[model samples]
Every structure is written in structure tokens, then in C-alpha cells.
Target: MPGRLKLYHNPQSRAVTAHWMLEEAGADYDLVPVEFREDGTRDPKILAVNPMGKVPTLVLEDGTVVTEVPAILAWVADAYPEKNLAPAPGSPERGSYYRWLFFVGSCFEPALIERMMRQDAEPLPKMMVGWSSYDDVIDTVEGALKGREFLVGDHCTAADVYMGAGLWWGGMFKGPRILESEIIQGYIARLAERPAFQRAMGG
Candidate 1:
């Protein structure tokens, strides 16, 4: 049996990704909603659980706290193997799982943030920049998503939950560059159909 799990979340935030993961993993958990002040400060009660004051923080029965969206999603997958939301440890597919999961946080996120903020005017050397270029990151993801349903294997895993949420948000709010990409739009549409995704969105 799994430990008692509680998820601190804000519906408008990235916590939705973890919510989808929990639903996908079939994990019974409680959702603690956190509200942000107009000044952008989080509730102090939540800050006690996550100093960063971020949503998507997971607290186990032993009070082991887990932060970060990707990390939380990864843990849920492994914690509920019966859901088949990830490849087994030490398998080749697991390598793909780890690669894309980390890439979303390390590479894709920075790239998207840079593009959305229009901070690309100052070009840094490839070595100095972790994400390199926005276009490069987009191309890499497009290549991986092409002719495929999920990031790791034929089945949708936690990686898709993370990456799909980012893609869907980007296309919805980022700009025409993302919205114009048929592959991405189509992929997001497919992800939106999943019951887990719908439930997380409060549908």
C-alpha cells in the first residue's frame, strides 16, 4: 500500500500536472488548495510545507516533502507501478523517461520562458546557456512527438503528463509560434481528451 499522500495545489498553476499524475496513477490523495494574495504572495501555511511557496508540493504520511512538478510526477509514477505510468527501473525505456522528464524542466522550460519574455535579444554562448535556443528546443520536441503518441513508449506515461501540460499551456497562452504548430496543437487536443486530464482541469 502507498503512504498517505497529500497534494498542495492551486488550480491555475503547474500543480495541475501533478494532479493529473495522481489521477493517472490511481493514487488516493487529498488536495489542499492554496490561494495567492493580490500581491503574489502565497499562503504562509503552504510555505511551511514548501519554503518556495510553490504549488504541486507533495507531503507523504511520514511528512517527507517533495517539491517541483517533474519530481512529483516521477515519484507518483514509481509509487504506483500498477498504473503502468512508467517503464521499469534500469530499462532502456526508463532512460527515455528520465531524459524527457528532466529535459522539460532543464531545457524546454527555460527555452519557453525566454521566448515568452522576449529575452532572446541578448545571445549567450551555447555553453553558457542551458537551453541553447528556443527554436532548437521546439524542434527537438517536435521531432520526438512526431509519429508518436507519448514521450517514452507507446503508452502515455508521467512524462506525457508533464510535457503535455507545458505544451498545452504554451499553445494556449504563449504565442502564434506554438499555436501554429499543428503537431503540438493536435497533441494537446489528444491529451485534453484523457479523463485524468479532464478531471485535473475540474471538468
Candidate 2:
């Protein structure tokens, strides 16, 4: 059986994504609010759980630590199969599920960060960079949600929570401005209307 779950979080940070996921999973978890140093460094207590010192670190019931937004979302979904937030193992949709999850983490996230920070690196070959370009990443995500209500299946799942949170934050921060399309806006609206998402936002 799974042990007690605890999340080290900072509401203003990416931990909001995990907070949403935990709600979607319907898993009981203790929230450990972390304070940031005046210099913008993370609290050492958070660093103890995640050397990377990132918010959204999840400590499993058995004392296993899970970091990174993608990993935490995936773990929560899988751990609570009764919630059906993720596709079952060995199912065909599982491929689409994992693909979008990793795409959000590996591709879209880096691209958004680079644009937000206004990186000055010389243009590298599209093959060299994982994201290729921010526009390319945004276009791909837009295309995925063009006519669909959810990324993977008919109903909302972990993919929606993960990707939706990214899009919502991207628009909220106005950094990369990736959520400019009507399709994406509509999708985000749907996500925002969810009870789980509302609860995560403390509404």
C-alpha cells in the first residue's frame, strides 16, 4: 500500500501544477509550504527533498521523493488508478498520454523558459535544440488541442491537468505568450472550470 504523501510547495511557483494534479488524483496529501530566501533561493528544507530546490517536489508515502512536474503528475496519476486520471498500462492511448506529458515537460517548458529569459545564444540547428523553436512548440500544442476537448481521451485526465496548467501559467505570466489562440483559450477555459482546478487555485 502507498504510504502517506506529502508535497513541498510554493503557491507562486510551479508547485501549483502538482497541487492541481494531487486534487485530480483525489489523493490525501499534506502540503508543506516552503518559504523562499530574500535572495530568491529556495528554503533549505525544500532543497533537502529536492537537490534541485524546485517546488512541486512530491514525497511518496514510502518516503520516495519525486521531483519535476512531469514525474509528479505521472506518479500521482498512476498511483491512484481508481481516479482514472491516466490511461491504463498497456493501453494504446497510453502512448499518446506519455507523449504529451513528456512533450510538455521536455519540449514546451524549455522553449517557454528560453523565450521568457530572452536567451542570447546563437541560433542552433533545429535538430540540436529539443524545442526547435518556441513557435514550433506552441503550434504543435495548439494543433493537438485544435478540435479536441482533451489531449488524450474523451474525458479530462492527467494530460489535461499537466498541459492545461502549463498553458494557463504561460498566459498568466505573459512571458512567451503561447496561449494566444482561440482553440487554446477555449481549452484553458474548460480546464479552469473544473472543480479540481478550482480547488487547487484555492477558490
Candidate 3:
């Protein structure tokens, strides 16, 4: 049966990741675009769903409200295994898969945001910030993606969906400096070649 997926989205945001995930899973979903005014105010109804009023919230057919980007993608991937978007826990690949998934939210994201801010907050203790330094985090990313076409390996898993999307966005920004690696360049170019990515970009 087709899963009922309600994607609260706007093309201009990270909802594009959710959009690509939906397309990859071949899920039956309704893409609902929520609009805000030029002054940056949102509908009271949307604020009810997400107090932060962020885009890309996924509401399951059963009415479970999922928040955050990585959480939503991981949930959607696990919910539909036949789609093969994730690696099973018992599989050796699962560990590495989870690493990238969590890294996207835990490390890469915060680091990217900090770089974009061009300001630093009080440093998190080494143990507190999962990603210690921007270069360290990026070097880890380079290591993970260096020799492989995908994060874990040859197959594109949910990890890549998030990682690749994050790469695409970071590539747009001046920080992270990913293009220098031939591997990263090839991998990101591969992601861009995906029909889903193309369609998302109006290809």
C-alpha cells in the first residue's frame, strides 16, 4: 500500500531534501506549500504545527508529527524499507549509515550555521560539540566521501540523501570548500545527475 505522506514544504527551503526523499521512496504524498509574507510572518496554523515555524515538517498518514530534517528523513526511510532507503541494523553498513545521518544534524549542520553566522558562540566542551572544529568535521566528511561514490558505499542510502543534499547546499555557500577533492566533486556531481535532483531544480 502507498503510505500517506503529508509534506509541509516550500521549494525555497530545505523542503527540497524532503521532496527528493519522497520522490526516491515513490511514496504517495501531498506537497503542501505554506507561504509567509515578505515581512517574514507565517500563518497562525503553521505555527501551531511547528513552534519554530520551520518548513519541511512531515505529518504521517496516521497523524504523527515529525520535526527536524534528519529525523524526518530517517523516519521515512525506516518506515518504508522495501524502498531500500536505509541499511538494516544487523547489517555491517548500518553503523556507518547512522554516522552520516547523525553527523548531518549533529555536526555538519551546526558547523555550517556557525560558519554562515561568521560569529562564534561560547565554545562547546570538546565532548559537548559532537563536531570539534569546522576543519575536523569537514575532514571527516572528506574521509567518508573521499574514495566512495556514496557515503557508506556504492548504494545510495538515506544517509546520502541527507549528506548529498547538505553537500549541495554547502556547495552553494562559500564555506566547507568541498570542490577541491576529486572524490567529493565527482560524488556531488553524481547527486546532481540524479533525475530527482534534476526535477527538484526544475530540470
Candidate 4:
């Protein structure tokens, strides 16, 4: 087993998703809170590990640093196979798991940012952007959860943790159509009921 991990986090940021994943995996970890500064300078400790100075930066026992939410979630899930937070390697469900995991960072987040942050700006050409359009991204996610309890197999996995966290965060911020959709809201509610999720939220 790997030694205890260290996660640089800020509760108000996307690091919460990584925190949720750590809880789900039942991994032994320490939360190193990274407070934001008015002048926009990052903690030197964070910069010493990650030049980007992003939260959710995970330092492994071997001193390796893992940045990005999805990568951290994937690593923790794999590191604790006994937790069953991931599908069996090379299984068909694993493909779907990876699909949704990447979907959040690649599509959902970008689309959400555009819809929430770039409302007044001219809509970028769909062909020129990786996320295409906000509507399409939301539709795709809704379709994925239409009749399924989880993103991959029958039970919760790292995919659900990642996707669920994204949807929950989106709804919390009143992202367009996210809270309005019954399917999305139901999924968020279901995920919120998970003990790990609740703990991550400090409940």
C-alpha cells in the first residue's frame, strides 16, 4: 500500500471534488489548505510542487505530484482497489468510466465556464472550440444519466464521483439548465446522499 498522501486544497474551489474522491477511496491523506491571497500570489509550498499552483494538487508518498482533479481521482481509486471506486482493469465498464471522467474536464467544465462567465461575449464558433456548445454538452450529460444510476457499471465508481461533483457544483452555482433539469437534479441528489460526498461537504 502507498503511504499517506498530501492534498493541497481549498474548500471553496474544485479541490472539493478531489477531497470527495479521497474520502470515497478511503485513502489516508492530509489536507493542506491553500488560502487565496488578494494580490493573487500562490503559496510558496504549492509553487514548490506545482508551478501552475492549482488546488487539488496531490503529492504521493514517493514525492510525485499529481495535478488536475480527474488525474487525482483516478490515481486514488486505483491506489485503493479494495475500495472498488473503479472498474476492473480492461473491462468494458472501465472504458465508460474513463469516458465520463474525461468528459467533465474536457467538456462540462469548459461549457459551464462559457455559459456562466462568457455570457456577454460573442459565442465562439462551435467548430473552433473543444466543448462545441453549452447546450450540446448539457444534453450529452443528461442523456448519459437518463436511465442509469451510475455512469459506468451498477455501482458508484470514480466516474460517478467526478461527474456527480461537477453536476453538484454546477447546480450549486445555478448553471443554466443544470438545476432545471429533473434528470440532472435527481442525479445530483442521489450523489449527495453518499456518505463520502456528505463528508466532503463537511456535513
**Stretches of model 1 off by over 4 angstroms after superposition:** none
lDDT of 3 by residue, 128-167 (tens): 6767877777888888876688888578888898988887
- List the candidate 3 regions with Cα displacement exceeding 4 Å: 38-40, 119-128
Instruction: Write down the TM-score of every candidate.
Output: 0.94, 0.93, 0.89, 0.97
Residues 34-142, model 4: lDDT tens digits: 8888898988878988999889899999999999999999999999999999999899888989999999999999989888998899878999998899999999998
Q: Which ten residues in a row have the lowest lDDT in candidate 2?
A: 172-181
Better of 1 and 4 by TM-score: 4
Candidate achieving higher lDDT, 1 or 2: 1
What candidate 4 gets wrong by more than 4 Å, as runs, is none
How well is each residue in 1-203 modelled by candidate 2, as lDDT tens digits? 45579999888888988999988878888999999778977788898888888888999877889998988988888888888898988899999999998998888888888877766875446788999988898889989998899999898888888889988888877845455688889999999998889988763
The lDDT for every candidate, in the order shown, is 0.86, 0.86, 0.80, 0.90
Candidate 4 matches the true fold with a TM-score of 0.97
Candidate 1 C-alpha lDDT tens digits along 65-137: 9999999998889899889999999999999999999998998887787777866476556677898888888
* C-alpha-based local distance difference test score of model 2: 0.86
What is the TM-score of candidate 2?
A: 0.93
